[model samples]
Target: MKFKKRLWKKVSSIVLVAILAISVTGCGKSVSTSADASNVTVVKVGTGNGMPPFCSLDANGKAVGYDVDVLKEIDNRLADYQFDIQSLDFTTLLVSLDSGALDVVSHQLVKSDVRKTKYLFPDQYYCLSPLSLAVKTDSGIKTLADLKGKSINESPSSYEYSLLTSYNQKTLGNTLKINAVSDLSTADNFKQVANGQVDAALTYQSTYKSVQADLKIDNIKLTDTVLVEDTYIMLAKGQEKLTAAINQALKDMLSDGTLATIAKKNLSEDVFANYTSLIQTTN
Candidate 1:
């Protein structure tokens, strides 16, 4: 009987150990499955409507442009991530990005000191375009200094407007008169310049090209490049790791000639080359 009791106790111990081991194995499998499911990241991207050569919806309602293509390439490179782009108003895009409703935006987004304080800009600059004055071919206004005491299309919130305003405060002493137009469309602004309405329109080379392509701006001539604006992909605050990852991807794309190819395919120019020219000129 004593022998039988001892044998029964040993059997019980073995059974208990086996059960505990199975439970631990089951828990380990559950945790691993959960981790795998969590690994797939979905990124929400924000952009503005009617912004061509960067982001615009087709008649089929598909996002098409250089910015979109770049994001697609990044998505392809990062297999764990899926990017969903939502088109919103330009103001709303900034608000949404700040509010964490959107993870990223690159609607010709330039780096500014104010934005730098609030957002994370990857070290990689994806594109650059020269800002020029779109004036009537006969106007002969080759520089911003010519705008002194003349009417030019100005948006209260624009890089060109800011630069012009600063120039006024510094040298011109408010001599430049700004014609603030209610309609800020590039086509309309260019039209104003072409029709002798505004002295000149501050416009980006890319925007001027896109507008010219869509409509005949035969009368308008773009002045010498004034501002070589650097464009970047902006992320909302507190996304350091994601920003680093994207910067790495951008670096890879630059090294592999992927970025230049995309720019050529979309904008018909090597945007990186333009940026390089800016750096060289600055140096």
Candidate 2:
């Protein structure tokens, strides 16, 4: 009877150990399965409407542009991932990115030291036509120094405004009368300059080129001051993996001449060459 009792106790101990091992193995499998399900993530990209060459909506309401093409390239490279594009205003794009409403913003945002603090800017994929001062041809403002006391119109919270503000603070010793305009769609700001409501307006080179032929501007010269030459794809903070992936895809695009081909198609010039030089110099 004593031997039988001892054997029974040993058998019970072995059974308990087996049961505990099976429970642990089951828990591990559950955790692994949960992790796999969570890993299937979709990255939402934010784009803006009516921003040609960068982002626009087609008649079928599809997101299309140079930015779209770049994003598609990234998707192709990252076949394991998926994406969806959301359209909003340029101003709203940043807010969405900050609030996690969007995973990435591809509006060709210019990289600034201040913005770098809040967001992670990937490699630059496009060079914006340089910023230039636009004045009515009849207006006799010929040089940057000539517009000392004159009011200039610029988009609010834009790199143009920042650049001009910095210049005023550093060199001018006094703030120039700068009118903050929110939208460039209506040309209301340009009209202000033309109607002499504002002394001048700062605008992009491509925009100036488009309207220069029609406007009575005597001369719209591109200033030697290149304010924010290249634009980058921006990812929100703490997105190290996504940022690295985008940078790698961009490098590959550059290597295969995809970027240059797109730039030439849109701008009719080799914009990529200039962008490459700017990136090398800045880095």
Candidate 3:
């Protein structure tokens, strides 16, 4: 009996040692997994579905376009960063970012003195096509002078409107008849000009290009040589870390020609090359 009791004691001691070793190994693995999970970073980006060539949803319910590609390239370079795109209207993006509902605005947002006061914009990634005055092919208007005293339609509070008003005051020396619309979807503004309800339309170059074939606009001309160049991407004020990371990533992309390639694929032109000089000049 003494021998049996001694053997039982030895067996219990060995069992306890085995259990302790397993517990230590499990704890180590749990810690390693936790650290790995913590390495993943999530960035919330805002986009406008109304803007095409910059950002929009495709038929598969996936966000895909020039801005999407640019953001993806940034993510790919970061390797551990992930992105979640939130769709909103053009005007709401800045407010959403300010309200902390979004970390970044990835749509085609132009930087202005007013915006600089509220948000931090990184180096401009994409320079949008300049705004121009588009008229139907049948219209005899061919220059800025021709648009004098003409009725024009544009979205209210948009850069287009601001540009038009500036041109009217500075170039035309008079304010033309102005009609403000709410959104681009109605194209009511465009339709107004197309049906002769309005004499001309102030809009983006891309907007004119997309509808030119449909609208049969042949007399589209750039007036006053005043180009409105838009640079996109904005971060909330004080988001230094995110802004730095994005700027660095964009700089690398721009150097490696990734941005030029993506721009060519989406916009059908080497937008980066065409606009790089403009960006440098502005800076």
Candidate 4:
């Protein structure tokens, strides 16, 4: 009887030890699976769909473009943060960013003093492009002077509008006619010009090149450059930390030639090269 009792005690001890070991191992895996930051800080980025080479939806319903690529590279370097993209229309993007629905925007946004009052821009720009007036080929419009008292359509929220507005006020003494459109595509702008609804349109050189053939804008021609603006990833107001982190990532990419590589891959040229000289040449 004594021997049986001792044997039973030993068996109970062994079973308890085995059970405790299994419990510990299971607990460890559970803790690891739900590790820190599972409730992570996710950065919401907004971009417009169908804006090719900048931001667009792929067949897999993914955001793929030059802007998206740069954002992904930044996200890869930021382990503490997860970045997600929401595709919206061109006009809706600004509203969403202002309402805090989006944390960042990278649809070829240009920094301007007017914009600086509303949103925060990073310290560096990822790309640059010259602004020019797109008009009908035979419109006989060749310079800013030709736009005097002439009508042009542009998005009110766009920097192009502000640029043109500045030119009207400061350079031309506000004689140019500015038509504010809520939303307009590159094709639509060219169409308006082609149809003689507007005498001219303000657009980026890169934008014209990308959609010129598609729009079949044989009748439209670009005037001499008006201004050159550097494009940046716009952030919501008061995101100083996020802005600094992104700026650092951009600088790293610039130094490592990643920025130029991405530009070449998407734009077919190094848009960053000689940007200073290009901007200087703009009037």
Candidate 5:
């Protein structure tokens, strides 16, 4: 009887140990899944529409471009965060962010002085987007000197407008008539210049390539770069955690050569390969 009792007690102890081990593991898994689901935060990301290769509407009106893809990849790496991307007008992006409707602006954002004062930016730059002047072949606008006292088209909310405004003030004596146009697409701006409606328009070569292929625009010629803008992801102020995550993602993308691949697919060239020649920079 004593031997039987001792054996029964040992068996009960073994059974209880197994039960507790299984229970703890099952409970841990359930709790971990629940915590993961509940802790994931949704981040609102915004990008400007009408800018091709960076952000634009597809045939189905879905937002597609390098900026969009980069945001998606960033979202993928951060399991704790979900990104909801919105493609909107260029000017509307900044306005929405200021109103607290957006948590991030994923457009090829230039870290201008004014913007740096208002928005937070990741430490790593994703791309170097250089700006050039688009002019008619016979427009006699070979250089900035040639654009003196001439009119140009730009968006009021853009850094181009500020640059042109300041350039006109300092050099052209405000004679460079800068037409503030927000509704015109980038192609239309080039079209206006091609049609001689404006002497020139500050734009990107990548944009002209899309315009040329899509609209058969041949009269416009791109001059040397005027600005080499250091583009990065823009976040609303005080988002240190999100900013850190984005920076890490950018660094990883760079290390893995994904940034170059994306740029080549959309921009037709690696925009970052020794992009050091420009009249000025938004660094």
Candidate 6:
């Protein structure tokens, strides 16, 4: 009787172990990207969806694009932190970052004096956004001077708006008729311009190409004029350690040519090359 009881006890223990293993494998919510999580800090990164060439969601709803690829490379270097990327709209991204729901914002973010007061921008920048005015091919708008007293539609929360706002302050207040549209697709914004709803749109050439491929945009063309802006990774004001880690990762990427490779793959060119010249020329 004692021998039989011992064998049954062993069998029961094995069954219990099997059940626990099954439960752990089947329960999806608790699983993490990290194989071991005792020492890793998971960073919640918020980027935009459908902002292709910069950011977009895949079929599995995972964040994937130029911005996301940069962040993933940064994550690989920082063994101490695992980045959890979330796909949010442009507006929701900043809102969530401000509210601390997100640890970082990586959707081709730019640093401004006003933004500096609210967020911490690391010393190293990851990308350059070459912005230009997209107008109807025959709008006869040749230069920035042409935009004076003319109307343009842009999102209030966009860096383009901020850049234009600075231009307005430096030259004339509200020189360009700025229409504040909170939400719109790139294709839709071009449609607005194509249909003459607005005179122009502030955007990048790569962005224009991405939008152009999605829909017919024979009526629209990007201006030869460009304004180059540095894109930074935005973090909350107090996260010193994270900021330092990110900066270090950025430095390494810069040194290793990884950043340029990634840029060439996603952006169709190595934007880093002669970017400073572009900035100087534009400014």
Residues 1-283 of candidate 6: C-alpha lDDT, one tens digit per residue: 9999999999999999999999998775432354555778889998889898889877798777899899889988887788998888888887898788999998877777678888887888898778778899999986777888888887887767776777788886438878888778888889999999999888887888887887877888889746787789999878889999999999899889999999999888888895756762211
Clashing pairs in 5: none
Error of 6 at 135 (Å): 1.0
Model 5 quality (TM-score): 0.82
Clashing residue pair totals per candidate (backbone < 3 A)? 0, 2, 0, 1, 0, 0
* True-structure Cα RMSD, model 5: 7.3
Q: What are the runs in model 3 whose C-alpha is more than 4 Å off?
A: 1-35, 143-145, 211-228, 277-283
lDDT of 3 by residue, 1-283 (tens): 9999999999999999999999997776231222364786788888876556667677786777788888877766664557787777778876788789888997666665666777887774554555556666667776656777888777766655665676677874556877886765524556666678888766655655555545554444334323546576788887888788888888888778888898778777776666544442222
Better of 1 and 6 by TM-score: 6
Ranking by TM-score: 6, 5, 1, 4, 3, 2
Instruction: State the C-alpha lDDT per candidate.
Output: 0.77, 0.70, 0.69, 0.80, 0.82, 0.83
Error of 3 at 120 (Å): 0.7
Q: Write the per-residue lDDT of candidate 4 for residues 100-146, one digit (tens) a residue.
A: 89999988887777778888888888777667889988888877788
Better of 1 and 4 by lDDT: 4
Model 4 weakest lDDT span, ten residues long: 28-37
Off by over 4 Å in 1: 1-37, 173-175, 180-183, 279-283
RMSD of 6: 5.4
What 10-residue stretch in candidate 5 is worst by lDDT?
28-37
Worst 10 residues of 1 by lDDT: 28-37
1-283, model 1: which lDDT tens digit per residue?
9999999999999999999999997776231222363786788988766677788888898878888888888866765566887877676787888778999987877776667788898898877767788888887678877776778877665555666776788984546777665537778777777778778887777777887988887888888787687778999887787788788899999999999999999888887876576631210
lDDT of 1 at 132: 80
Model 5 global lDDT (CA atoms, 0 to 1): 0.82
lDDT of 1: 0.77
Alpha-carbon deviation at 2 in model 6, angstroms = 28
lDDT of 2 by residue, 1-283 (tens): 9999999999999999999999997776231223463564588888887666567677798877677877776776764456787878888988898899998988767777788888887774545455556776766766556687889877767766777787788875555787777766625555667677888776655555555544545533434434436778888888888888788888888888887787676556566665444342222
